[model samples]
Structure formats: C-alpha cells, structure tokens
Target chain A: MYNILLFAKRELRVFVDTPVGYVVLAVFPATMAALFFLAGSFFAESEATLRNFFTWMPIAMALLVPALTMRMWSEEIREGTEELLLTWPIRLRELVLGKFLGALSLLFLTLLATAMIPMTVAYLGDVDGGVVLAGYCGTFLLGAVCASLGLLLSSLTRNQIVAWLSSAAILIALNLLGLAATARSIPPSLAHALETLDLGLHFYSMSRGVIDAADLLFFLGLTLFFLVCNGLVLERRLRR
Target chain B: MMSPDSSVLAVKVQGLKKSYGSIAALQGVDFEAPVGAVTAFLGPNGAGKTTAIRILTGSLLPDAGSVHLFGADALRSGQDLKKRVGYLPENNPLWPEMTVEETLAFAWSAQGRVGHKMSAVERVVVSVGLEPVFRRRIQECSKGFRQRVGLAQALIHDPELVILDEPTNGLDPLQVIQIRELVRELGRQKTVLLTTHVLPEVEALADRVVLLHEGKKVVEGTLAEVTSVKAGQQQFKVTVNGSEEDLKSMLATAGVTRLESGFPSSSAQASAVVLADGGQEIFEAAVKHDLVLLELAPRSGTLESLFYGLTQAEGLHV
Candidate 1:
C-alpha cells in the first residue's frame, strides 16, 4: 500500500512536469464539452440533462485514455528508468497499482471538470441528481477499465506511438461491442456473450442511475484482469 | 552457498545459466565477492559482466543457478536482501524532469525509510559533493553531475553491498579522477562490485579482480595475484648513450635480477635492460655510473596487458 502511493506520487509529478499530461488532462474534457455543446446541439435538445456528455465520453475515452496512459510504461522502458524502478525494493504490483491510480487520478480531475455541464442543466431546468451522480460513477469505472488496458499494452512495447495505436485499436473494438451484440453473423450464443461482455453495456446501465452490482463487478473484474496481465508481462521480461 | 551468518563472502553465484532465444547471455558462470573488498569485474563487450551484475542486483533472473548475497538467497528472498544492496546500472538511469533533491528523497522512500528524510538526503548530497546542484533538474546537469546523482541515490540507503556498472563511462579525465576518489573512499567502508574496461581503474581502486570472458570467469584473485604473470617479473627498458656491455657491467654490481639487452618493446631498439626488484633503482644505478639516461620505462606489467592476454586467449578481445 505504501509503495503504491510512492510510485503514484511520482507518476503524478510526471504529468505536472511534461506537456503531454497537461494537454491530455485539459483537452479531454474540452473536446468532450465541445462535442456536447457544439456538435450535439446542447440547447436544441429537448432535455435538461448532460446525457450528451455522458454519451460522448465512452467513445472519447477510447482514444483519450490511451493517450493518457501510453506514456506510463513505454517512456519508462524506452528511457531505461524501468530498470531503476524494477530493481527498487518494492513489489511489482505496488508499482503497477501506483501508476494506474496516478493516471486515474488525473482522469478523475478531468471528469470533475465536466461537471459544469450537468450543473448548467440543473440551473436551466429540473435535472435528475441521482442520474448525474451515477453517470460520474460510470465514467470513472470506464476510465479505470480503459486505463488498465492502456497500461497493459504499454508494457508490451518500448514505443509510445505503438502503445497508443495498439491500445486505441483494442479500445475501438471494445467501444463497438454493442454492434457485435446485435450482429447476425456471430451466432446467437456468441452474440449473447458479446452483449454480456460489452463494456458500453455495463457503463450505459450504470449511467441510467441503476448502479447494479453486476455492472460494478464487471468493471472491477476487467480492471483487475488487465492489471494482472500487465504484471505478468513485466515479470516475464525479468525471467525470460 | 553461504551460511546465513557468514559475512566472509559478500556475494556468491554458482552454475548460473541464461539464454535469450538461442543466444546464451550467461552459461555456467560462477562468481564470488568477499565482504569489505573492492572487486573489479572485468570482461570484454560480449562478456556476461552486466548480466551477472543484473542478477546479483535482483533486476534479472538466471535460467538455472543460485545467487547468495551476504548469505541470503537472492533468488527467493525477493526484496529483503535487496534492501541491503545498492545498484547503479549502466547509463545511470535517472529522472530528467526531477531535481536532484527530489530524486534523493524518492530513493529514501524506495528504501522504506521515510523518517529523517532531509538528513538522509543531505548526507548523500554532501557525500557525493552535490551541494552545487541540489535543485537543478537532472537533464540540465552535466554528465559528471548526473553520475554523482546516480551514486548518491545508490548510497542513500547505506546498503551493505554496492554494485556499480560502468560508473565512469562517459566522463572527462578530471571527472574520472573524482569518481575514482569517491569509489576509493566507498571501498574503505563498504563492499563494492564494479565493472570497468579501464585497466588502470582496477589497479587504482580494486583490491580483487574478477575477469570474465565469453560468459565465463577466466581469472579471479587479488589485484597483484591476477596480474602476476603479465607484470609479475620486474623488467625495465633502458635507453642510454653507453653500449649494451658497458650498461650491463655498470648494473652488474647492483642487487639486480637477470638482465637482458634487447629490444623487448615493439616501438624501440634495445639500449639496455635491467631485471631488478624495482624500476626506480635503474635511475640510481645510472647516476652512480655517471651515465646519461635517456628513457627508462617499465615493461607492460599492468592490468591492460593482463586483460588483453586473457581475452585474446578466449577469443573475446575488446
């Protein structure tokens, strides 16, 4: 626990020191807000809620979260700092968890920046408070899942661009999970599994103020799955 | 394997084997470093010096073998033994965006000793003479200062065993001298294992030498013991105006060993030769004879020749 925070603190500092971190943190919400107000026609919609922002975040995070997490391990490995970190007395899990939490913390702040859109909706007219809070919860869960995916892919390569592209490809496939669920060619059983496995399905279910245990379990389990995979890859490098 | 209570041998590895695909990085390499001694790990470029250092420092795993550090199982102990180990890897990995103070503090946290942070960092800073660039970012500092930072971080925890790989690779002569001084000081109190191609560095700092070739140790012993054959028999080259017989007769009465008069060195013809207990006595003999001495150089009796001879025999010459 202590080692995790030790690494997490360093990861946070990396964001502050580098322009990439600042650009990702600010641009993520700015682009989301722009898509919400400009492209989606915020005032023209006949609803007093931030449904547009919540709807756009899944697709936005598919690319944006990868951008944020691409540098997590790729830069460390490329620059040889990975050797220093690995040889430190801390366990490998603590280092991975610390960096993951550090990246998620930035995502938390970016999500918080978009709260003004819902706050504006509430000011204009009646808005569902439970739904707004649940949407924020759902966003955090999605970011956690995507961030872990980015981290796992980042460990597989020394190049940040490769990490970014590979993670973006997988994330794009995940974002399109709903389409696979309704496709006819994948067979009824596989299509059913696809719907059950869909990230968007769980996130959307939570966004509607449901907060089901199954949805939370799916996100938590998937995040843990990817974190374990990342840990395995790092350990394998040391061994083989 | 060393018993847990034994401190005579600081590190021991046996039958270590590692391979990447079909290329073996280490094969049946055995090594040991005695406690409280400065040991030099010498090898050619493709040798397993760095590979061995990586395993000892807990950064790399060997395919088959065991490593015991200060009598602790390095393979299975996880981070416990590593707490007593400090490693400065090749290239001196550091955070360029971080200030020297920040890097030191992070190392303190890494050792799981968060209390007395300021004193610990300040102690290392002073030890490395890093007071001038305490707040400077790593990228802005020169390579020598960056090396000082690397050394400082490695020593911040005061580990029992310190391992440095190519610590003075890209430094000026003055910087090398400074690092050599610091390393010599470190050897007085701590057990140090360093790898270098610089033969004089071994002569100046190492108490013991371990020379590896083609992933195997070809020579390991005391500095004098290891270089005994190459530089053991004392012989000096002499260049004087006197004839060979005249020079030989003048030094015949001196307490000298067998003297040979020939061109033993490649770049010069033989003026004279003195097989003596020490090279300085040649000057005294020349002065006593009123002979005009031109050049008096010792034969290649140093680590450089020993390194070349050993590696060349193994076909691993650098």
Candidate 2:
C-alpha cells in the first residue's frame, strides 16, 4: 500500500508538473459546462434536469480518459525509467495501483466540477436529488473503469499516440455499439448482453434513480480486470 | 574473498545464462562477488556487462542459472534482494521535469523508505554534490550533475550492495576523476560492483576484476592476478635506439621468443620482445646490449589485455 501511495504521489506530480494536467482538468469541465448550459438554454421545452451534462460526459470521456491514462507506462518505457522503477523493491501491483489511483483522482475532480450543472438545475426547478446523486455516482465509477482500461493499453506500447488511439477505439466501440434502437429485430438476450457492455446502459439505469447491484458490479469488475492486466504487462517487463 | 566460515555471501551465481532469441547473450557464466570489497566487472562493448549487472540486481532474470544476493535467492526473493540492492544503470534517467530535491525524495520513497523527510534528502543531495542545483530541474543541470543525482539516488537507501554500470561514461575528465574519488571512498566500507571499459579504472578502483567476454566469465581475480600472464615470470617492454635486427639479436642471445616490434616512428627503432620464462633475466639482457634502451618499463598488465587476449586467443564457452 505504501508502494502504491508513493507511485500515486509520483503520478500526481507528473500531472502537476506537465501542462497536460491543467489543460485536461480545466478544459474538461469548461467544455462540458458550455455544452450543458448552451443546450439547456436552447431547449426550453425539455423536461429532464441536467440531462445535457450527464449525456455528454460519456462521449467526452471516450477520448479524454485515454488521453490522460495512455501515457502512464508508455512514457516510462520510452524514457528508460522503467528499468529503474522495476529494480525497486515494490511489486508490480503497487506501481499499477498507484498510477490508477492518481489518474482516477484527476478524472474524479474533472467530473466533480461538472456537478455545477445539476446544482443549477436544482436552483431553477424541482430536480430529482436522488437520481442526480445516482447519476454522478455512476458516471464517476464508469469513468474510473475507462481510465484503468486506457492505462492498461498504454502499458502495452511506448508510442503514446498509438496507445491513445487504440484505447479510444475500443472505448468507442464498447460504448456506442449497442445503441442501435432501430435494430428491433435483434434477439432480446443478445441485445441485453450487448447493452450490458455499453457504458450508456448501466449509466442510464443509475441516472433513473435506481441503484442496481449488478450495474455497480459491472463497473467494479471492468476496473479490476484492466488493473490486473496492467499489472501483468508490467510484470512481463520487470522480469526481462 | 568470502570467508568459508562466514555465512553471508554477497553474490553467488551458478550456470547463469540469458539469451535473447537466437543470440545467446550469457551462457554458463559463473562467479561470486564477496562481501566488503569493490569488484570491477570489466568488459568491452557487447561483452554483456550491462546484462550481467541487470540480472544480478533483479532487474532482469536469466534464462538459466541461479543467483543469490546476500544469502537470499535472487530469483525467488527478488523484491527482498532489490530492497537491499541499489543500482545505477549505464544511462541513468532522471525525470527532467523534477527538481534535484524532488527526484531524490522520489528515489527514497521508491525504495519504500518513507521516513526520510526533507533533511535526510538534503544530506544525500549534499553528499552527491547536488546542493547548488537542489531547486533546479534536472533538465537544467549539466551532465556531471545528472550523474551525481544518479549516484545520490542509488545511495539514498544505503543498501548493502551498490551496483553501478559505466558510471563514468559521459562525464568530462574532471568529473570522471571526482566520481572515481567518490567511488573509491564508497568502496572502503561498501560492496561495490562497477563496470567499465577503462582498464586503468579497474586498476585504480577495483580490489579484484571480473573480466567478462561475450556474457561469460573469462577471467576473475585481483588486478595483478587476473592480468598477469606467465605468472611468477614477469613481463617487460623495451624501446632501443638501434637496428631492429640488433635489438632482436641482443634479446635472441638471451633466448627470448615471441619477439614483437612497435612501429618505427622517426629516429628510433623500437621493439618489444617477451621472454616466455624469464623476468629479471630479460631486463638484464636489454641493459647489457648497449642498444641505447630509450625506455624499458614493466607492464602493469591490465584487464584490457586480458579481455582482448581472451577474446582473440580462444572463444568463450558458447
């Protein structure tokens, strides 16, 4: 755990020292807030509260989270610092977990800043507090899972651009592949399985004020799977 | 130089081998570095110097053989060994974005020793001569300073053994001398294994030299013991202001074989001949020839000759 924390601290410092942190942290919410306010103001007849904010985050994160996490190990490898880090007494899991927690923290802060849209809705009308709270919880958890997946992919290659593009591609396919409502002829079981893989299915369910155990389990499982893979990738390199 | 009665062995390897695909990097390399002395890992480029260092430090596992560091199995107890071992790789990478102070703190923390706060970090920085650049980012520092920071990182935890590979690679002559001094100082009390192509470095710093060739231990011993050939029968080089034939005849009269000559540059005919079995006898012969012996000096006999001699004379264990 101490190893993980130290890794996390180092990761945090990387963010603070580089321009990526400021650009990502500030731009994410700024873009989300602009789109949310603009959509809300333009569509006066819309009945739902803060739907615009929650709706855009999934799409925004598909590209953004990969950009944030793909450099986690790729940079280390390219810089030859992997040799130094692997030589340390810390286990592979500790290093991976540290990076995961650090990247997740930054993503968490970005997501938190978007909460202003929900707050604005509550000020303007009778917003469903329970559903709003659940939506935030779902978004945060799903984002964490996506970040972990991106970090794992990043660990696979030293070229940051390749890591970002591949991670984004996988995320886009998973998040958008099941949303063809027009394909009504598809079998129910297969469609449900496909929807289970979608970020929207689980996220939308939570946003409706329903806290389903399976949905939370899905996000947690995805996060753990990718984190484990990240650990494995590092293990291969450590022993070499 | 491990005592037979002593239970602790600094490093022990048996049949150590590592192959990257078809190219067998290390094959059947075996040796031991005992506790409490500096051992020089000497070899030329592609001699697997860095590979051996990596394997010993637990950064790289071998394809075959076992390594024990300080009585712990290197393969099984890798993390435990790594905790007790500090390594400074050939080209030490510093996070250029970090200040000298920040980098030192991170290195200390990376070793899992978090109790060392700012003051302790400062002490190491000062020891490594990084005080002036404590606040400066590593990218802004010179190459010498970067190396000092690398040394500081390796020494941060005060590990039982310190492994440095080519620590003097890019430094200027002055920096090289300073680093050598520091290494000599560190070696007085710690077990240090440093790799270098510089033969004189081995002569100056290493108590014993381990000559590696093509990933195998070709030679291992104290400087004189490893490099000295025809042991107990000394060697000499002589330059005479006389005809090559005259010098050869003079040494021939004394019964010297394997007579060799250096290129005649300008006014002098310089020749070096070896007496296969004579030491002082050969020296006396050169003096009596009236050959105007311009220079006659004893060959300090270095790991370089041993390395070149071993690689050329016979191929190492494949």
Candidate 3:
C-alpha cells in the first residue's frame, strides 16, 4: 500500500514536471467549452442546464484521456526504466493501480476546470443542481474508464504514438457503437448487445440525472477489466 | 573453486534456464556470489550475464531455476527479499526528467523504509558523491554524474547485496577509476556482484571471478585459480639467443618441458614456451650453455588471456 502511493506520487510528479500535463489541462477544457458553446445546442433550446456540455464530454475524454495516459507505461519501456521500476519492492497490481489513479486524478482536474460552464449556466438562469452534479459524476466515471483502457494499451508497446492511436481508435469505436447509424446496420440482438457495451450509452444515462445501479456496474466492471488485463500484460513481460 | 557453503553465499542459483522463443538466453547455468566479496561476472556479448542478473534482481523470472539470496528463497520471497538487494542494471536506466533528489527519494520510499527520508537520501548522496547534482535534472548531468545517480539509488536503503552491471561503461579513465574505487569500498561490507568486459578492472577489484560462455558457466574461482595453468605446473615464455636444440637442451636440464618453439628468426632471438616454474634453474642452465636469455615471463595466466581463450573457443562466438 505504501509503495502504491509512492508510485502514484512519482507518476503525478512526472506529469507535473512535463509539458504533457499542462497540454491536456488546457486542451481538454478548451475543446469541451468550444464544442459546448459554439458547435453544440447550448443556445438553441435556451435551457438552464449543461446538457450540451455533458453531451460533448465523452468525445472530449476519448481524445484527451489517451493523450494523458499514453506515456504512462510506454515511456518507461522506451527509456528502459521499466527494469528499475519492476525490480523495486512493489507488486505489479500496485504499480498498475497507482498509475491508473494518477491518470484519473488528472482527468478529474480536467473535468473540474470545466465547472465554470455550469457556473455560467446557473448565473444566466435557473439550473437544476442535481442534474449538474450527476453529469459531473458520470463524466468523471467515464474518464476513469478511458484512463484504464489507455493504460492497458500503453503497456502493450514502447511507442507512445502507437499507444495513443490504438487507444483512441478503440475508444472511438466504443463511443460510436450506440449511434443510430451503427445500431440500424447491425441485427437487432447484436445491436442490443453493442448498445449495452457502449461506453457513451452508460454515461448518457447518468448525464440525465439517472445514476442507475446497472450503469454504475457497467462503468466499474469495464474499468476493472481493463486494469486486470493491464496487469496480466505486465506480468507476462516480466516472465518473458 | 572453493566449495560454496549455502549459508555464506549472498546469491545462489541452480540450474537456471530461460529461453526467448527459439533463442536460449540462459541454458542451465549456476552461479554463486559469496558474502562480502567482489565477484566479477565476465562474459562475451550474448553470454547471459544481464539475463542472470535480471533474474537475481527479480526483474525477470527463469523457467527452471531456484535463486536463494542470503539463505532465503529469493524467487519466492519476492518483495521482502528485494529490499535486501540493490541492483544497478545495465545502461543504468533512470528517469531523465527527475532530479537526483527525487530519484533517491523514490528509491528510498520504494524499499518501504521508515525514517527521515532526508537523512537516508543524504547518506547515499554523500556516498556516491551526488551532492553537486542533487537538485539537477538527470538529463542535464554528464554521463559520469548520471552513473553516480544510478549508484546512489541502488544504495539508498543500504541493501546487503549490491549488483552492478557494467558500472563504469563508457566513462573516461578518471571516472572509471573513481567508480572502481567506490565499488571496492562497497565490497568491504556488502556482497558485490558486478559484470564487466574490462578484464583489468576485474584484476584490480574482483576478489573472485566467474566467467560465462554461451550461457554456461565456463569457470568460477579466485583470480589465481582461474589464471593458473594446471595444479603444480606453470608456463613461461622465454626469448633466448641460441639454437632451438640448445634452448631445448638447456630447458630440459632445468626440469622444464618445452611446450612450443617459436619460428627461427635471423636475429637468433626466438621465444619458446616452457612448462615449469624453475626460473632460477633455467637461468643457471642458460648461463652454463652460454645462451643469453632475453626475456622469460609467465605466459597464459593473465585475466585477458583466459577470458579470450575461454570465450573465443569453438562454438562460443555470439
């Protein structure tokens, strides 16, 4: 447990010391705000809620989370520091969890930065705080899922670009699975399975102020699945 | 080689085997490092030196092997045993973006040590001479200082067994000397196992030598034991100003056997190998036969000659 925190602190320090952290911090909120205010329907319906912000959240996270977590394991392998790290007196699971939490923390901060959009919506007119709170909760959970997936892909290769692209591609596929076009082209039963597996669909349910147990379990289960797979990949490398 | 008592051995491996796809990295190799001694691990490229070190340090696992460190089952102990062993792997991998201070802290904390972190960091900092670059980012430091940081992290928790792979690689002569001095100092109290291609460094620092060839233990013994010719016989190269017949007869009278004769030269100064340590008797025989001895020095006993002879033998080339 102590070693886990040590690794977590080291990961956070690396993020803070490098430019990648600031880049994500700036790019994520900027893209989310631009899509919400300009490209989204924030003014078309004249609603006093951050519904458009929540709508654009998953897309923004899909692009930004991969960029945030791509270097977590890939850079270590590229620099040959994995030997040093793995040889330390720490378990593989702790290392995986610590890095996952570190990336999740940064994602949390990125989401926190966009709080001003909701603040602006509240200042302009009446806004339901419960829906806004649920939206933020759902967005953070969605980001955690993305972070774990990005970390798993990062462990598979030493090239950060490959890690980023593979993670982004898979995430974009999962996000698009629930689209009408995708659902219509597939058979009904297959489409239903894909919809249940869609990452964006689960977040969409939570964004509407409905934090159902099924949706919570979906996010948690998927996140754990990716993290376990990440651990197995690392363990296999150690044995090899 | 002295029979290693498992109790006194800092590191012990038996029948260690590891293969990558079709290529075998370590093939049924056994190695031992005694407590409080510097054991130089020498091998040619692809001789499984790094692979063996990785397995000992718990960075990698072997398919069929048992690693015991300080009388404990290292392969099973895992993290608990790792705290007692410090490893500076080949190439000295480190976080280039981290400051020297932060790297030491991370290493110290990774050991799960309980104390004032500053004091622990300062101790290694002083030992490895990392004070000047303590706050400097690793990437900004020179290769020598970067190597020092690598050493510092390995020693941060005062581990009992220190494993260093090519510690002075790519350093200038002065830096090499400094690091060798530090390694020699470490060997006084801790069990030190280091791998190097530099044979002279082994002669200068290693109390024992282990040579590997083709992922197998070629030799393991003290420096004198590894370099010695047989049990009681010694070989010497002698340059004499006399006929080959005269040199043979002279050496024969001194109880020395001529192993090989060099090519006859016009200058009448030919070298021959004599298998005996009768230096005084050979000199007396040469004087009696009126054969002027030019040079008579021990042959085929230096670490360089032994390393080349063992590693470059048939089927040993990488």
Candidate 3 Cα misplacement greater than 4 A, ranges? A180-185, B1-7, B230-300, B315-318
Cα lDDT tens digits, model 2, A110-139, are: 777666767777777788888888888888
Clashes of each: 1, 0, 0
Which ranges of candidate 2 are over 4 A from the true structure? A39-42, A46-48, A180-192, B1-8, B230-300, B314-318
Residue lDDT tens for model 3, B1-318: 223333499988899999988998889998788887789999888899999999999889999989999889988886888999899989999999999998898888888887899999998899989889989999999999999999988999999889999999999999999999899888877888999889998999888898987789888888888887644556677778976667767776776665556445445766776657557877898898889998888776677756765665443211
Shift in Å, residue B283, candidate 1: 31
True-contact fraction for model 3?
0.88
- Every candidate's DockQ is 0.58, 0.58, 0.73
Give per-residue CA lDDT, model 3, range A65-169, as digits (tens).
898899999999998999998888889999999999889877877788878788888888999999999988998889889999999999999999999999999
**Just chain B of model 3: what TM-score?**
0.80
Number of the predicted model whose DockQ against the real structure is largest:
3
What C-alpha lDDT, on a 0 to 100 scale, does residue A101 get in candidate 2? 92
What is the fnat of candidate 2? 0.79
Interface RMSD of 1: 1.0
